[model samples]
Target: MASREFLKILSSARLGDVLAQQKLAEAYLTGAYKTPIQPANALIWLEKSYFSVTNQELKDKQTSSNSTTEILTQIARIPLAQTFQSPAFGFGWTSFWQLAHTKAETQLHLAAKWQLANLLINPDHQEIQAQLMEFLKGKNISSSLEAIAGLDLKGLQKIAKQFLQELAETDSPFTSAAKELLIKLQPKNAALSSLWISWLDDKNEEALLQAAELGLTMARLTLGLRLAQLDGGDTKSNASLKKAAYWLELAAKDGDRDAWYALGEIYRRPQFSGYSAAESDRCFDRAADLGHAEAQLRKGANLWRKREKSDEKVRGLQASYWVWQAHQQGIAEAKELLGKILESCPDPQKNDWHELALQAEQAINHHVEHQLDEDWLLLCHRIVIANQFHFSKAELLLCEVGQLQHEHCVVVDIRWELPKILPRLIQIETIQQRRALLAAGKVFASSDLEIEGNLRQRRYRFDRVTHWLTTTFAKANKHQTNTELA
Candidate 1:
């Protein structure tokens, strides 16, 4: 909700007040009054203020308008892999280019040109790929980009390439990014490079920086690691860590798990100016999600250590799930830790989880072997929910999925089954896990009254479905073994 004060400012802005317009734009740009940061909306009022001041209206407000416009321009100057989700994306390039071009009477032109050129050539992101069709049709073409092209595709790319080359020749924050994009755009250079990635580890600063600028992940990663090293705990040595973070963040954004892990370590260094345990955990989690075996084991171990939290047993189960993922990736430490954890925790039957998943898919249908396949489908949903959220069997069977959702966790209350049992809170973890829960919740949402009757009837249904699934799995398991042997 827009605050009453902000609403007054908005009303005044709509009534042709230039100061109100500028204030409203600033508020939108900076998310003032709990407003969502909407760059497109900011640009609208800003453009109004810009031309208004240019027309000799409110001359005193000129400098502040210019400063705000430049800030918006910088925000528009994002990376080559940006997902274009806003009209502000179009306006950013346009506004940023004009601002930078005008400011380019000095050194700031390089930043503006870097953004315009890269955005023209290098946005091969999957999200942008869909819009290539629109680009082909010339539908949604911005005039600034069209003007920069100087000709068709060939001249457009050539102009962009020239801008990148010019930017790289100068030293600035965008220099490395410009060079990396140029290297990526030119396959010939990538093909001609004969230097082994291993050689980067022992390379000098100049050699490493040059190669890293040329989009070699190994060189950039090595350079970042070298810079991130402690310099005898000198608090004044923050410059090195900042530079390291810049290079590492680029690699991490490009989906390098190793870079993500390294970044996590860098964030955790006590001597670093920006040391943050929470940021370190987020980086490690990203690495873990990207299938880093060591990260998975560490994440699992960390979760297990915190098992004495709210739902201790459920926490242990959740921790085991991460360890299980690590085990599949062939981590020896994960296997050892998993063995020890399983020794203390009660797990389900030793059937392959993948195999059980397949069986669930097979059994959740009209069955030739039994008339209880319908209930078995609901049973599969229950099993998936229990395994995902680490709910108890009774909670899985009795808790209403719709009713149990809290902000960050699921409230599993089976006091309906056993009056003495208290409600337990289980935190939602991954998006995949959340999706699985939502899917199961949807099934139970549409269920008939018979499917979710009294507690005694529900338990009886659960028992029948379990028997059916067990019997079916046994037959299929034996048949598969016999076929493999024969």
Candidate 2:
């Protein structure tokens, strides 16, 4: 119910008032009074005030609260010359017509009347098409037709096409809205059309399953897809159909990549109770090419598991490729796995392996801080350092590195004392050069160095302490002198 004050405002608003027009437009646009203020009525009065003799300041009042560009465009398109003349102009011409085809219907009637009048006056069928063709010569009617091809009728289609051609370059959402409105106005086939749309807004698996059994293509596709994904050894009774394989195969053949992927997975990964690896690989291979990333990863992993060197090399490369693609697209696990593989590999570097290693480390840190996936943190640390240096080197310096950790340390026997002469052989260069040598498991070998001096008994401790100080002091002095010169 509107307040007495609102009703009083409306009564005053009807008498050619600009403030009233603005207020009424707001009320209608927002449903201010809970009184079902019709937009059509509000638009008519607002448009009237917009074009009439009124104070510029009052008439130009526009709100920024809501901006539906399509609605504004449609409102702007209405001709002011013939609007609100009388009921004869049309039945209730207003903003409500923007939501329906009535306004277009009225315009169509007018256009038809002009065409009919011209035809009656001239009465030449050949001349009519020739004149129409001449009028539309430069106009690209095909593009216009394509835009409104969704509309049902020839007349509205023609008009919409022409309108689109005129506004081809304009930024408007009206074409979509107009096309939707045209669909609403279309005549329907009452029988088959009743069940044309299938909605599933709630969780009712049984209903979906039953529908699928009854031969609804969508339902069959859904259920067959799901059944194909069940772990290989479930009870036979729950298999849904003895022809389960048949329907799933059919769904896959029908361009359902998910179904194809699912079918491939089933055939490839059958349990002791159920498929063979060879069968599963074939399915996975097909699905992978059909743009299924999971299938590609699965196929690659499966191929690597077979221990066939040629296949292992191919699959590892492909697995890395597909996983990297997925990782770049924001899949976190793919990113982590790719990082690990890149770090572990010894030969040709296909990507920035170190960057990926850091990515894995940072991601693991984030996860660990949130207590989300603590396992990845340790794994990330191990892989990153291992990739930066040799495995033994990384393991030995694992304590020095802040983020990476191992589950446990195992001592491996060395046959003889490490050559202390090796450090003297290569002059200590960059900090990174020293780090690289140390990480390659040199620390473990260096532990055996014999200190033949006054510090002989505490040789192990003395040598390590001396080495640490010399490396640290040397790097610090180099950096300091460079800084001082600068």
lDDT, each prediction: 0.67, 0.43
lDDT of 2: 0.43
Model 1 worst lDDT window (10 residues): 343-352
- TM-score each candidate: 0.60, 0.28
lDDT at position 414, candidate 1: 76
Best candidate according to TM-score: 1
Candidate 2's TM-score reads: 0.28
lDDT of 2 by residue, 27-80 (tens): 765677665645556566566555443334343335321223223333443332
Cα lDDT, model 1, residue 65:
68
lDDT of 1 by residue, 78-104 (tens): 442342555434545455556454633
